[model samples]
Target: MSGHRAYTPSLRDRLTKAVMTAAGYLPGPLLRPVAGAPRRVDGQVLDPHFQAGLRVISLMSEGEYQDLTLERARSVVERSAYTVSGRKIDLAVVTDIVLPLGGADPDRADLPARLYSPVDGDEALPVLVYFHGGGWVLGSIDSHDATCRYIADTGRLKVISVDYRMAPEFLFPTAAEDALAAFRYVRDHAAELGVDPQRIAVGGDSAGGNLAAVVCQQTRDAGEKTPDFQLLFVPATNMSARTRSYELFGDGYFLTRGNMDWYERTYIRSDDDRLDPRASPLLATDFSGLPPAHVATGGFDPLRDEGEAYARRMADAGVKVSLRRHPTLVHPFVNAVGATPLAKAALSEAVGAMRMALAY
Candidate 1:
């Protein structure tokens, strides 16, 4: 738990990284004519680097998630995580552990988790209980290892990345219930984990973000202690309906409309389940007492409109919320922190907000 090591990339991974890094440096003028004039939708032009990257991805991709079998889709995500997550950050402590699910179900399997702590920090630090994205049907602690390491090292805080149960196997409410359980366990055991119970934060991207928002609402409605802050990146706030962003950017973006439909079908029981507040936090009755939040959205992402709408809803309900729209980015920017400087900077900004919010 008190050492650091670098992740050795495979030959294919290294080659892929090299190609992407090179593409990032290409002049915009050279890329524009080929990738099509800088796409301007919703008043935001797509980042030239990302446009080039997307072109590369499209050329290299085997198939979209909607077209791949579930197992193949999951494998593709795992490989992509390693390829684009960059090198792992060095931290003072990194350890794998199991979280006991001790709530209503005593017989449930313990969740796999990883804890990351920076070298420079006090004995007790603010902690972010993070969840990985993949429409709740993919991703794992391994997939988000670099992300947690980056947050822990750069933010000078502790991070516990939860490996929640996924879908097509563990249906609706399972992931949501597990997320709540993980947060509760961390809060209740903060002392043992050497984290500040008073400053615990909940965060995640995509489906994971949905869980974080739901956790806040669930705690509020149940009259329990809530997270000190919430960080949501490209969150699917409302799953019941598609928004204008979906209509605009859903086709060519990394997260396509068909992919989202597949995820929903794999994760939920029926159309009615999509309307449940647990599945769609925006449909919740109240957002007034939820913790302060930073909702970051990519202008080109299908989830952009809903994410912004969620932030607005929270603010209107009297919750303090910060909505950051990265005009030139896409859905997976958070995962690409190591692959590109811009993505790294974007994550740094969000982590900076988390640090400031928990500084007290």
Candidate 2:
């Protein structure tokens, strides 16, 4: 009863914070209190929040990059949250093929994308360019297998899930560039790629959702063909540090404010970097002439307020906007698979939205 409230996140959130709090504070160098480091960690994984705090302090102390390294955080986060155990790639549509997009590093650079079809590669189908969520830090096409497959199989469309560049190493604009490059690649070879040029749409959840909106906005501005519709699932639309949601749910919902700080620091360079419209779309002055869009917000996400605000602003700017607020789920809950009922419902609604986008 103490956790119950007529608001997003609900008891689930209070419990997480309670747990984090129960863990007892560690010095600024042993965050999370893990048993031991993994045998072969490719990046830093904190056992304690303060350990992360220590790293930040040390970075500042050593005059190093005091900012967060999403790349480093992701190494630990994937182990806890984003790691997938079951099927990594499930293509329910026509037939699924995982193709390698051209990347500089064959082992690392060549982006891995999945092609989901409603039918054989012979027919043209409406296409969806999907980017998955992980705060641009973690998550891969494999982590979001079910959702993308559901979209292609149930929505009766072709889907392309992009494995965009993430943070720390290829920071901001790189992922954005990858998103655009993937779209352009799909557009340039629509016929050969088995897509209908006019029926293409862009979509993703959380960070991916942000990329989706950015893709559309950039397309319109660059005089490129716009996706028929845009689907944003609990998008992290505005990185501005001033949103009310940031103050409200910043410390809980399994996505702590510290975590966000970690993610954003990895994504952008400085406060001045926030000025880059590419970093925060809400910072953009003109939302006019962008494609019709649907922006979904998690009532509990720190990014929720900005997501809805962006949608309303879009509507006000004359872009066809459909906004839905799921006041019961937490950020990235859509990727929680079937664990949470609300997540299931959100997933269904997301597929339905994508179907609508293709229908139009």
The candidate scoring highest on lDDT is 1
Point to the candidate with the largest TM-score: 1
How would you encode candidate 2's per-residue C-alpha lDDT over 1-360 as one tens digit per residue?
Answer: 000111222364445434333333333224333423322111222223323223332332312122435343443333323221212334534333434456575323445677887576477878889988877777677567657766776577888988788876677877887787778778777898878888888999888988888888788889878778888888877776658777777653556577667668878877787777777888888999988887877766788888888899899999888788876556776555423334556667867776676574
lDDT to native, each model: 0.85, 0.66
Model 1 stretches with alpha carbons more than 4 Å out: 1-10, 22-36, 102-107, 120-122
lDDT of 2: 0.66
- Across residues 44-112, which tens digit of lDDT does each residue of candidate 1 receive? 888877787778678779899878887777777776777677665788989988887744664355788
Q: Which residue pairs does candidate 1 place in steric collision?
A: none
For all candidates, the clash counts are: 0, 13
Cα distance off (Å), candidate 1, residue 280:
0.5
Report the alpha-carbon TM-score of model 2 versus the true structure: 0.73
* Weakest lDDT window of 10 consecutive positions for candidate 1: 1-10
